[model samples]
Target: MPFENICIFGAGALGGTIAAKLAASGNVDATISVVARGAHLDAIRRSGISLFEAGADKPLLANVTATNDPTELPPQDLIITGLKGHQLAPAAEGLAHLLKPSTRVVMILNGIPWWYFHRDESNHAELQFEELDPGGKLWRLIGPERVIGCVAIQGAEVSDPGQIRLSNKGRFILGEPSGDISADLREIEALLNRAEISVTLSERIRDDIWSKLMGNASFNPISALTRSRMSDLMADGATSDQIGKVMKEVKAVGEALGANVGISVEERLEQASQVGPIKTSMLQDLLAGKPLEITPLVGMIVALGRLTAVPTPVSETILALVSQLDRENCRTA
Candidate 1:
C-alpha cells in the first residue's frame, strides 16, 4: 500500500501546505489528518486545511481530519512532525501511542538534528549533543532508523488558524538520516513530487542541512536581536563580516565532527546573499509571543564546537547575543 492514511503531527502553516498538496495528488486514499489542539484544531476541523496554492492570493481548502487527541487517530502509514523546535518533546509524547511499526516519521525541523552523525565512523560520530535533546527523549523515542532529514527552505506562516499565507519558496531537500537510499525515502520523494512540491533527493543531506544552519544560526538570531531585515544585515560590511565569522566557525565544527561540508566560507556567504532579504521564522515567533527555537537553531552549533574540540569564536559570540535577547523576550512576555 502507498501510504493511504497519513497524519500530520501539527496543523499549523507548513502542515496545511503539505496536507493540501498530498491530498491533491491522490497519493493517499483517505483524508489526511492534522493533529492539533484548541483553537487551531477547531479552526482546521471546521474550515478544512487551507493554503495559497502556488502562491495564489486566496486559499485552496481541502477536506482533512483535524483533532486534539492522537488516540482518536488510527495507526498511520506516515507521520510528518511539522512542529516548532520546542514542540518536539510534546509531539513525541503524543506520538508514542499513535504510530505503528509501519509508520515512518519525517522530521522536518530546522537547525542541527538530534541524530546527525549518529552512525558514522567519524570522531564526533555517536556523540549526542545533550543541549538539543537534553533528556534524550527524542533520540530514544524516534530512532535514527525512522528519520528522514529534511533541509526545508520554504517559508510560509499561518495568517490565522484557519488560513496559511504562502509567502515564498516552497522547496525542501530530503535524505535519510543515515544517508542511505531506501524504500521509504523513495516513497516520500514520489509523494512530494506528485504533489507538485520541489524536492531534491540528496546524498549529502547533512552538508545541505549544515549549509542552511550556518545562515540560520547567524542570521536568525542576529536579526531578532537587532530587529533588522536581511538586506540591511547583509548590506553592512561589518555585519556581513560577522556572519562570515560564524560560517567559518560552523565549517570548522562540521569538519572536526567528521562531516566534510566542502564549501568555502565566502562561497557560503555568497549563497546566502542571493536568497534576498526575507524575514526569518524566529523573528515571527518572537513577535507572536511564542518561545524562540534558539537552542536547536543556534545552540546546537555552539554545543558541537565543544563536542568536536574546535574554537567557535563567532558562533559563540552570536549565541550569547541571541541568548540575551531571548531571555529578555521571555522575561517581559
Candidate 2:
C-alpha cells in the first residue's frame, strides 16, 4: 500500500517543513505535491521550498509540485494537512478533490481535533464539538473513518513566504482513533520514516492527543494574552505558577475522560522552558494579525471540562479573556 500520490495541504510552516523534508529526502519514491497560496505558492513554484534548519550552513531546497488549486490535482493516496484547527473546515470542500475512497488524511493539528469523538468507546461516542468543527462540516465532508490522528512534536515557522525555519527536529506520533494498528497506519508510518521524518505509532491516539493538549491548551492562549515567550513565562515564578494551575485543570478534565497525560505539571514546564525563547503559534498569529486558534486550543478544553463535570475555573477564566482578545484581533484584522 505505497502512497504514490501524496499531497500536503495548506503548506505553511509545519506543513512546509514536512513537504520540504519529504521532497528533499529522495528516499521516499512518491510524488510530493503541495497545495498552498499567495506569495508562498509563487515562491515554491519558482524555486521550490527553502528549509533553513538550525545550525545549517546552507538552506535545503526541495523541489515538488506546488499549486494553490486542489481541483487541479488527481486523487491522492494520502493528504497530510498542515493547516491549523480553525483553518480545516473552510478548506474541506477544496480538500475533497484530492480524496478517493481509500485516501487517508493525516490531521496534523493542535488541540482537540474534529474527529475526537468519532469512534469513541465511551458514552461520548460520535459527539461533535462545534467549537472545533462548527456546523459539522469537517465531520460530514472529510469522514472520520478517513482520519489518521497525528501529533507533530516539531517546531517550525514560515520565516518568509517560501522559506521555513526549523526550530527543532521533533518526531510525530500517529494513530487511529479506533485504537487499531491497521495496515494503512503501518504503511503511512513507514513512508514517513523513509523520508527521514521520525514517527512513533500509537494504539491509543486519544491519550496522545490529550497529553499534547495539556501543554497547548495552557501555553498557547497564555502566550497570546501575555505576549510572552516560553522561556519568559517559565522564568517568572508567578506566571509559571499560573500556567501550572491551568495545566492541572486541563489535566483534570482529560483524566475525567479516561486520558492519561503521563507527565506531571513540573516536568512539562521544565520541558517547555528548555525550548529557550520560542513564541507559541498563537502568539505569533496574533502579532501577525491572523485569526487566533482559540476555539480548538482553549474553547474546546472548557467545553470538554463541562461535559466531564470537571471544575476548570482557571481554564474558563483564561478562555474568556483570550476569546475576547481574539475577537478584537479579528475585528482589527
Candidate 3:
C-alpha cells in the first residue's frame, strides 16, 4: 500500500525541495503537508512552496498544505524529517504527534543520526549514544523500528521564504539499518522516483552512511572554520591533507563498528574537488547565524570511536574547534 498522507517536518531547504518535488508530481498517491515555521510557513500558506531548479527561469509552485503546528495535520502515513541533525532532539516529541502506529519516519539530514548506532537488537545494551541523543529522547520517542536512514546527495538552499533553490541534483540513497530490502524501502523509493528524483537502495546502509559522513565530518568543519567552499578546500594542499587525516580516522572508526566505507581517502578528496566551489551546509548555516550541526557530523563519530577504542585525534581536534566556534557564536546571539 502506498502512503496516503505524507508530512514533511522541518521543511527547510532540503525538506522543502523534496516536498516541492513530490507535491508537484501529480502521479504520486499521497497528500503532502509541510510542517514549517516562521516566515516560511506564512509564505507557503499565502502562496505554495516556490521551487527553482538550477537551469530554470521560473519557479514551480508545489501545492502542499503548510502550517506551523503538527497538531493541525492528520496522523501521517509517512513523516520525512528534513531538519539538521541537531534540530531533531528538541522536536522529537512534537514530531511524535504526527505519528500513528504504522507511520514510518525517514530522516534525510546530513551526517550520522541518533538512531545510527542502535539498529541491532543484540547490541541493545551498547546502543546508547548520549552525544547525539542526550538522554535517549529520540531513541525512546521515535524508536529504531520505524526509522529509515537516508543519504541526501542533493544540494539545495532557501533563496527566500517558502522558496527552495536546487543548486545541484543527486540521488537519495535509502536503506534499512538491518541491511534488508523490505517493503517499506521499496514504497518510499517508488514515491521518490515518481517525483522524478533519483533513488537507490543500499544493502549495507552503514557503508553508505560512512561514505557520506566521511566528507561531511572532514570537509564541513574545515569549510565552516575557514568559510571556504569545496573548490577552495580541494585547491589548498595543506587543508586537503587535514581533510585526509580526518577521513582516515573516520574510516578506522567505521570499520571498527562493522561498516565498510568502500572508498579510499585520496579518492574521496578527489571526488570533493570535482563538486566545484559549493559552500558546505555547515558553512552556510554558520553564515546564516543558525546553530552549527556539530554533533552528528563530527562529535557523534568521536563518541563512536570511543566505543570501539579507535583513535580519532584529527576528528577530535576538529570537533573541539568547531564546537567552540559554535558556542562563542551562540553566546553573543
**Each prediction's whole-model lDDT (CA):** 0.77, 0.89, 0.86
lDDT of 3 by residue, 1-333 (tens): 568999999889888988999999987878999889888899998888999987788998888898887888888999999988888888888888888888999888677777775555344433767777778888888887888898988878787898888877677888887779999899888888989989899888878989998999998999999999999999999999999999999999888877789999989988888988788899888887889999889987788889789999999999999999888878876
Prediction 2 TM-score vs. true: 0.97
- Misplaced by over 4 Å in model 2 are none
Which portions of model 3 show Cα errors greater than 4 Å? 121-126
Order the numbered candidates by TM-score, best leading. Answer: 2, 3, 1
Clashing pairs in 2: none
Greater TM-score among 2 and 3 belongs to 2
Give per-residue CA lDDT, model 1, range 1-333, as digits (tens): 367788888867776688777775655465588787767678877877678754487667777877888888888888887887778876676876666787788878788877786766675567676666768887788766777888887877777776777767678888886778877888888887877878888877888877787788888888787777777788889988888888888877777766668788888778767766667778777787667888887787888788777888777887888788778888888
Better of 1 and 3 by lDDT: 3
Residue 324, candidate 1: Cα error in Å is 2.5
TM-score, one value per model: 0.92, 0.97, 0.95
Clashes of each: 0, 0, 0
Q: What local lDDT does model 2 show for residue 203?
A: 90
lDDT pick, better of 1 and 2: 2
What local lDDT score does residue 66 receive in model 3, on the 0 to 100 scale? 87
